[model samples]
Target: MLKLLNQLLGLFCCFLMTACSSVPKLESNAIAPIVKLPNNHEELGVMSAYSDPWEGFNRRMYYFNAKADEYVILPVVAGYQKITPDVVERSVHNFFSNLDEISTFINSLLQLKLFVAGETLARFTLNSTLGLAGLFDVATQIGLAEQNEDFGQTLGYWGVDAGPYLVLPLLGPSSLRDATALAFDNLVFQQAINELGLDTDEELLISLIDGVDARASLPFRYYASGSAFEYEHLKLLYKKYREIQVAR
Candidate 1:
């Protein structure tokens, strides 16, 4: 249930970001700065030079994945207008709150002092049960506030630094550290899901679809900003945003 809720909430957040923004003219020049291969360009360059076949394969797969994401997932979500920007925003907030409680729980078990876990269990439980499965704001009434965390933040907490920025083929922009964190998080999640007896291929498929849906639901408020440099603008904004998240 938590997984599904998270997926939906994630899609809502993505949709909000995409839908709220106006499409600006795509400018090749705008890409120059953001895409300028960084100092560690050597890392990616080495991969390409020494492992041309693998790099090519990865690039193809990435492009296919991005195409699938934009063409297949985005439209399905665009059809779900009833979700609404307001509801998506609120659900996102509540979802984060619930996760904060869960993170607290995890941190407690892991002996991490970075965050308090499990204190919000009562609130989460109540909200999940009485608040119509976390679609409402019941948890807020009791002051069990929401805190958001992701694999990137987890990595930062463990002292991993964000290494050079890289635009992943289909995954989009992420740093080396953030990408590694993503993989680690997936592994952990897979193990947990397996332990819960819900890690079948079908289950995984549903989860992926849920994730895409969640992303698609986010309003693209910035897209329509009437900026000629939309792509670069978003790229810069997201880089800073992710960095802040990692720092936190």
Candidate 2:
């Protein structure tokens, strides 16, 4: 049962990572200042340079995650999409995203990003009340855009190195530091859920429903990117994306 719960949790994270898989185009002028890779960079050399000491384990886990997603998760998501009204799905997304703002606000405060912290606090308050428990994104409409922050970014701000690339059984691409942060964030979220007076069964039901809604909204399909080197690309993209997030 514990294993099943962890796998269910993975669907949510997998959707999140794969949904944002598009690599941002770096300006040619900015590359020198940022990455500082050699002018004569070789594709193979760069790919090989990506640190993945646990590649053997990671590859096996990645295969398991992909298969679980293809067989179990996507079918449920498909069924959910077929039955649920579009507006209801959007509300579910908004509601979960609003709950996430709590963690984002806390992490922002930890990183001492007072402006982001303030914005997140205001956004949560406005959305919870004016947006009707975040069924609507009133904050974004009113120019209070959501700020994305996490404990991983907070650790990064304090100069914590992304230790090593890791592929969790269902969770997808992460690093030692980020994985630890993920666990921490989940614990904090569970505590918040408890404070909201939800019983264990209610929390579990919400999680499963959230996973379905999340996977339904994302367009990513495992092994569908059409790149022969999909694994390598995924690793690089995730790393670079996290770097960009931390930089911001």
Top candidate when judged by TM-score against the true structure: 2
What are the clashing pairs of model 2? none
Write one digit per residue (lDDT tens) for candidate 1, span 149-240.
55666667677776655446545545567777666555555554454466478667645644544555454432354644444344444455
Task: Give the Cα lDDT of each candidate.
Answer: 0.52, 0.77
- Candidate 2 TM-score versus the reference: 0.81
* TM-score, structure 1 vs. true: 0.55
Give me the overall lDDT of model 1.
Answer: 0.52
Clash totals for all candidate models: 33, 0
What's each prediction's TM-score? 0.55, 0.81
Q: How far off is residue 127 in model 2, in Å? A: 0.6
User: Looking at model 2, which ten-residue stretch has the lowest summed lDDT?
Assistant: 1-10
